[model samples]
Target: MELSTLKDAFDRASKKQKVSSSKVQEVIDQVGREIESAILKLQSVDSDQKSIFIDLRNKLVEISPMSQLEGSQKDLHIGLSKYARILEKHFNPDISKAYRNVDFDSHTVNQIIATHLYRHGLSDLGDFFMHESKEPSVIANAALKLQFLEMYKILDAMRSRNLEPALNWAATHRDQLLQNGSKLELKLQQLQFVEILQKQDKKQALAYVRGHLAPIASIHKVEIQKLMTCLLWAGRFDQSPYADELLSETHWDKIIEELTQQYCSLLGHSYESPLSVAVAAGFQGLPTLLKMASVVMAAKKQEWQEMKQLPMPLDLGREFQFHSSFVCPVLREQGNKENPPMLMPCGHVLSKQSILKLSKSSSRAFKCPYCPLESFVTQCRELHF
Candidate 1:
């Protein structure tokens, strides 16, 4: 089923819930006000018409009944239940097989999840899970935890306009960061210099520029010139010619994110945790796969589980594109070690198996299916990606 279908059901259920609650609340409030007004009237009425109190109580009973509220609640519950059933009908609960099919120790899975949670500051949840699972107090990758902890502390300090922690870290890891093609140190130093200039400390700012900005001047000459100009209008940096040099809330956030990405890259950890990446990719791909699964079930083909190749490409954006892509045009299958991609003379590519089959395994050159050029199997070069 399409997600839109399920979403429509959910929206309808939510609307029903909100409307029911609103009506119930209105009904209760109006009845309460009416009863209160009646009691007030009873207190002022003469004793000769003491029967007015009894009449007001009877009138209250007529205007408000507990059964009406119960009925509305029951109807709302029934509507929500219907939507739940519809949602459940489309839900596929067999997704565990994808992870289960991978040959990894289950205990290792629990450890990774617990460690990731702990690393993200969900200490209570992580500790509870670790204890319940009879895991050791410390994770096997305790060093990685300490590394992430130190990095997060620097990030937290950066949020408070303190770049010293990050500056110190960058200085310590200068060689490794440079080797990884990172300019994080220069970026951090530049920010610190800007922060100092914003304080109108002309002498101190120039000193900082000489010490920190001079070395990286060649690489970031234009950027440095812009920041140096901020020194001229130090008291009014916000209205300076290089107004962009003024740090923004969003700019600070970007720095933190970029630093984390670079830090993870240097340490060979994924920019995002492995579990987060996998879960995100799975969610992005699941709807299409689930629809395919439903179609396969309807046709009694079971193609979703048995098929070796998916029919379409997954456009998961640039962040997910870690390496070059070389899915063969002819076979519509991704290149693998055994059936690697072959770059033909015409610049068209195909899997090794597809080329062999298309060529009919003949000795003579065969026509290129995509173009006018013809090439023999021996002429096709293996492509790396």
Candidate 2:
């Protein structure tokens, strides 16, 4: 099911849960009130079991709602169970056919996950995992940049509405941030200016703007003007035209995200964990891979690893796409540096080996498979990405 459908199912389940809980509480309260009334009557009158039983029987109608509560609770349970099953069915794809036996270095995989954890500031857990794995070559410090981890810690603080860490970082790396053309530092300062203004300290806020924000005024003239305009709102920035800029928490989120990305870039690390990126790409192509595996198994003539390239393309979105690739149709081979793709005179492309073979070792002019144009071996040009 789609995301919206899944959300709708969850909503229905939540509603059912609430209804059941309320009904159960209502029944309990009713029973409590009746029991209290019966106890009071017994204390006022004769303390006999017969008398208590008679009183309870007279007020028994109050407890009749218990049956309705039971029915409602049962129906809600059934509905919630059905909803859970639907969600499970929607998420679980048929993967039995996609299973393949391949040798994996479990140790290396563990190291990658552990390293990923370390990168994300889960050092205690990473240390535990590393020690448990007991691999001498897989020290966390080997791949880690101390500064990068520190930067991540700062970003984490920024996410928690603590900007001091980020401010200190920006101050220390001012030149580097400017070198990278990062707006994050300025954005953080702007947020601080707004925060100071939020406290109704316009004087300090103005002083901060002039002292801190003015230096970047050349690069952010329009933004500085907007901030200056926002000063008129004073303690009521929420009612200002720049309310979206001043009152929203998402700006902090954006700043933190950009800060992390820029920090990684400055430290020569990827913005995302390599293992996470790989796993995401794998999931994106999993269904297609499963189908391909099934087709190969059914045919019983080929193995997936035997192919020069995949029969179909795997679209793992723009983030995963890094470079260009070309496969030669004539030779049924992928273009490589040694045997690079070449363009024919007729606008057709093939690998160098394919051109040679099609042209009878370049003794004769090679006719394009796609057209009637022919070209000499010397005429073909190598293609580059």
Candidate 3:
């Protein structure tokens, strides 16, 4: 594995490992080895990208404290910049003195410059020079470069349609935008971010549906067909909990019909038999059986009953022949008719019950005592004799 991937796997393992002395020591040793290997790989990266990452990391660490200074003088300057037109409008001379006393780092200077430019509608440094400013600007060239980089980041985010992060970055740099017209930048930001929340995160999606989708469905305004698609595909609802909803809800019927039709195409008329479709769909046991029953019941009652009343069909040549209605269920052959139940190789006589038992047996060793063909029982086929 690559050093980065190995480190990532170790980090994940560390997070999930049980709290214990052995586990802790094992993880510590693994991480120490990983870090040593990573350091060797780090030597091979281009110097400029490495320096950039290091500088960014240091800046993040330095600014970490500023986030905690709520209700302080620095907060007034920073927070007011989010809405106000000018730094002078929000900044107090006394607060400036206090800020100077605090030994502000390069990060703080960058932040101040970024904040000033952001509040004035000058998110993009390129556009800041277009509108001649009446107020004297004290922004350093380095700060402008930082602001330009930030604006570039927002632009990239806009192109990717990540509106939330772009909006967040825009809000932080609101002062820069108003003073300088970033018309093109703002236009780019206006592109709507499109996403289907259904597929984002399954747990979050389920929670959203339970909390939001269900209530909306109750009100009956939107077409939530895809939402039902997500639910059924996920198998989130069981027979009991979703029974009433599927029975009465118009949306669910469409989902069931579509799913059933697809299954029927794959499995043929046998699809109506719950066990057959369930097995074909890869659902085992009670849940599959329940879903199969639901599909049948949800189908048109007349059509389904007509299907059920039809006799057990036999494939004869190119056509399917349904046995006559007068045929006895307990008997495999119609008595006094040309057809009669016949035995196989060993010469024992029986009906469909015998064939069914052998075909459905889980054991491969199942041999028809009547026939020498051991384990050659074709499912529901008549004896050739």
Q: What's the lDDT for all of these models?
A: 0.77, 0.79, 0.41
Better of 1 and 3 by TM-score: 1
TM-scores, one per candidate: 0.76, 0.61, 0.16
The residue ranges of model 3 lying beyond 4 angstroms of the native Cα positions read 1-127, 130-204, 212-220, 233-385
Residue 152 displacement (Å), model 3: 9.2
The best candidate by TM-score is 1
Provide the global lDDT of candidate 3 against the true structure: 0.41
Please give, for residues 148-205, the per-residue lDDT of candidate 3 as tens digits. Answer: 4554465455445454555455445444543344322232121220122313345655
Which lDDT tens digits does candidate 2 get at residues 1-385?
A: 2778888888998998898888888888888888897778678755786878787877777468768787988889888898888866565567665555668898878877877887788877877877788866443455573565687778777767678898887878888988887877778888888889899988888898898876678888988888888789898888988879656878767787888888778777788998999889888878677767667545766776556666677777888866556788977777888899998778888899988888886658878888888899988999998
Q: What does candidate 1's lDDT look like per residue over 1-385, in tens digits? A: 5779888988988988898888788778877887787767767746434676677678668866576688778889998999988877777676543331347887888887876785676766776887798877764456666777788789889988899999888888877878788878887887887788778898999899888777668877887777677788886778865566446777678878988987787777777777888778888777556656566445776545566666555567776776656777877777788888889999998889988987887577888888999999999999874
Poorest 10 consecutive residues of model 2 by lDDT? 137-146
Clash pairs detected, candidate 2 = none
Among all windows of 10 consecutive residues in model 1, the one with the lowest summed lDDT is 94-103
Rank all candidate structures by their lDDT, best first, as comma-separated numbers.
2, 1, 3
Question: Model 2 misses residue 18 by how many Å?
Answer: 17
Local lDDT at 37 for model 2: 79
Every candidate's CA RMSD: 4.6, 7.0, 34.3
Ranking of predictions according to TM-score: 1, 2, 3
